[model samples]
Target: MKHLNTFNNTILYDFMELFHSLPYTFLGMEKSKDAFESAKVVLLPVPYDGTQYPYKGAANGARAIIEASRHIETFDDELNLELEDLGIYTLDELEISLESALETIKRVQEAVEEILDNKKMPIILGGEHSISLGAVRAINAKMENVSVLQLDAHADLRNEFKGCKYAHTCVMRRINEISHYVGVGIRSMSKEEKEFIEENELDIYGTNFNSNEILEKLKDKVYITIDLDVFDPSIIPSVGNPEPQGLFWIEILELLKKIAQEKEIIGFDIVELSPNSNKISDIYAAKLICKILSFSFFSKF
Candidate 1:
């Protein structure tokens, strides 16, 4: 058994060398193909799930999304463009200890601030919805009047949940404190959140609401935060919380395309994918990320 293990390691080493001489990045991109210094887009993996509830494994979301991206075709059919030339850099995953959610937010904020400082568009892959808080906070510091467009099953408007102000359940509430946002696919939330949304007269579109109407409310510069559970559970069941009668694949793409054409998507994050043994949801998440990136690339040039 020991000899067989050694042989396997040797073969793996040889294969890696033959395939890639540099560190791993999204889409299995070698260092030369997507150097950080020249890349227009950056993929930042935040694999921290300190505030998740009802499901655990969301901390592995970034790893699954990156692995699944390896299979994405470089050519985008919808836009009739090849996005590979744009230089997509996948930074090493953020080093996170199992700390309090506040500490995690600080770490993510610092990393995102650096990415913004470099003048690159940051695409964050999340461990949970709470991670978006840090990215949003960082972006808000740099860009004025930043509005968040949230795609999720829940409003996530709790001031605090499970005694943690930075809990995944309260992410949007924290975000709202800093910047204005519009919520879509919000079919689930507590009474308090519902009241909060109503009291504030927030611009939120329900699951059955028109997707196109979101365009009118969004600001010139928008940051998109997608929680995978916004999709019907039949298609993306491996999320932190699954809600039925959610948005479909095509509808989401159409909305994103429209937004890309009209609004400047400064940064975005896809979070809350609690991947199971099945690769189905992971692949879906990766494809969604790729589509958004493609649309974003087209918007720029």
Candidate 2:
């Protein structure tokens, strides 16, 4: 009995060591199950928060989201299918330098181009909303006409913020220069941003309207970016920037389902989650990813 106990303990030690050595992956899945070549979706994690201030923990978001994803059930009851069967490849986190935001975006753009070239749909997990700029730039290079659909609490249409044109607060402003955009769930914005929207007659579907109105304005190919702060603080309180009277879970999901049915969703990012001690935000972010992926891949609408 003593000899058997010793052998079991040795085996457990070896197993734990091997587990610790494995590369981190979304859903904690083995590489063999989700190989890059076979995958339909590729997850690019950009764990950078170079420009965020006050609440600055978004850099940890990618790691937290991936870690929490490991525990979710793979089967989707709404879709009535195992969405995991559609292979999801989680790449190593993008190594971005904090000193140069320009260089970081350039790196991200190049990486996204490579992912597209490989014919995989890219799902970016961001360090901040600014990261979407590079990914959107990459998408624009491949397709001649593309539109961006942003679901966020803030307009993000500032020309510049805090002396930096490339700050997260100005992400949509930068994107508007790249391609046309439609802003949804926006409850906050600066006076300048509001002026830009009104002057240009930009299509903004705010809390006052249902998301279905978004379908008419979007182009055939759309890149969707969701700032997690778009949700009410009650549901997800860990975001760097929180606004009151934001969209709830069901409302957002219903909108996404409609969009998936109506247009081709080329790529997307879920950003601005700053994990707390409870880790509930991380799990919510992960589930959001899974649900969106399932709907995008399998839904008729």
lDDT of 2 by residue, 32-106 (tens): 643777888899999989999777989989999998888778789988867567878998899998787778888
For candidate 1, report its TM-score: 0.92
Q: Model 1: per-residue lDDT, tens digit, 82-111?
A: 767777888888987686888888888998
lDDT of 2 at 240: 92
lDDT of every model, 2 decimals: 0.87, 0.87
Clashing pairs in 2: none
Kindly provide the TM-score of model 2 when superposed on the true structure, using C-alpha atoms: 0.91
The TM-scores of all predictions, comma-separated, are 0.92, 0.91
Judged by whole-model lDDT over C-alpha atoms, candidate 2 comes out at: 0.87
Residue 284, candidate 2: C-alpha displacement in angstroms: 1.2
